[model samples]
Target: MVATVNEFDQTATNPGQRGPAEHQRREQILRAAGEHFRHYGYRKTTVADLAKAIGLSPAYIYKFFVSKQAIGEAVCALCLGERTGALRKIVEETASPVESIRKIYKSLALSGARLFFEDRKMHDIVTASFEERWGNLEAYNHDLIGIIRRVLIRGRELGEFERKTSLEEACRAIQHTMQSFFHPILLEQNLDHLEEDATAVANLVLRSLAP
Candidate 1:
C-alpha cells in the first residue's frame, strides 16, 4: 500500500514511541535543516552548520538525520509532492487531453519555475540532490511518464489525438523534450521569454499529436 503524507508525518512524529518533546525537537531540526539547505547549497551546508542554526549540538542533529543527504531527500520529497499534485489535478480535471498537456507544461514552466528559481541556492541543492539520488529521480520520472501516457492513450480512444504514434514513444518524447525547462539551462538564458518558450514547446508537442 502507498503511504499517505499523514502516515509519514505520524511516523516522523512518533518514531519508536518517542515523547512529544522529542517529536517537536525532531520537527524543529528538520525545519532548520530545510532552511539551511535552501539558503546554502547542499555542498556548503553541513550538519554542524544546521546544529548551530537550530541551537543543537552536532551529535544531537545526527540523532535525527544520519547525513546531510538524508535531510536533502526529505526536502525533495516534500517539494516534489507540490509539483506532482498540481500536475495530477490539472490532468484529472481537464476534458481535453491536449489542453491537459498544455496546462501541465505551463504550470511546470511558470509556477514550478518560480518556486524553483526564486532561490538560487535551493535550485542548486535540488539539482545536485536529484542527480545524486538517481533511483528516486527515475521513479519520479517513470510515474510522470505513466500519467502522460495514460492521457495520450485515452485521447486516442476518444479520437482527440492521432492514433499513429505509440503511447510509450509519445510520452517519452514529451518527457525528454520537457527536461530542459527543469534543469540549469533556464538560468543561463533570459527568463523574460519563459511564457513564450513554454507555450511554443507545449504547442509543438500538442500539434504533433493532433487528430
Candidate 2:
C-alpha cells in the first residue's frame, strides 16, 4: 500500500510505538536524507544512500519510513510548513484582513520563487509530490485554503468584505485564483516578473473582496 500523509505526519501514524528513540531515529534519517536531497535531488537519492550517509542499514531505514517517497513527502512537508507558517503569522499579526490577503499573495509568490528557482534540487521533491498527487500535498493545499478562509471570514466580520458570498466558496475561489502564484511549475514560468504580477493579482483579488 502507498504511504499516506498520515504516515508523514510526526504525530498521527504512531502512538505508543513512536517513542523518543524512534522519533530520534526518524529525525536522523530525515536529516541525512534532506542533506542528500538538497545536494543531489530527491530522484537521485535512494534509501540505501541515506542509510550509508547515516551509518544505518537500508533495512533499518525502512523501519522508520516505508519508502523513499515517504521520506520525500516528509521533507516536502517541512518545506511547505515554512510557507504556511509564514502565512499563519501574517493572518495573526496583520490588523487589516484586506492587507492580510495582499501580503499572503506577495509572500507566496516570493517564497515560491525562492524555493523553485534557487533550490532546484529540493524542488524535485515538490515536483514529484505534485505529479504523484501525494496525500501530503493534498493536506498542504487544505491547510493553505483554511488560512485563506480565516482571512476572508475576518474580513466579513470587520465589514471589509462582501457579506453575501459564502465563506467556503470565497475561500476556494481565492485559492484557485492564486494557484499560479504558488504552484511550483506555474510559478516557475512567471518568475521573471512574479513580484509585479503577483501585486497586480493581489490588487484584483482585494478589489473583488471589497464591500
- The number of the candidate with the highest lDDT is 2
Displacement of the residue 158 alpha carbon in candidate 2, Å: 0.5
All candidates: CA RMSD in angstroms?
6.5, 3.7
For model 2, the superposed segments whose C-alpha errors exceed 4 Å read 1-22
lDDT of 1 by residue, 131-169 (tens): 566233554676678778878987898898998877788
Candidate 1 ranges beyond 4 A from true positions? 1-28, 55-64, 130-135, 186-190
TM-score of each candidate? 0.75, 0.89
After TM-score superposition, the amount by which residue 51's alpha carbon in candidate 1 deviates from its true location, in angstroms, is 3.2
Model 1 deviation from native, Cα RMSD in Å: 6.5
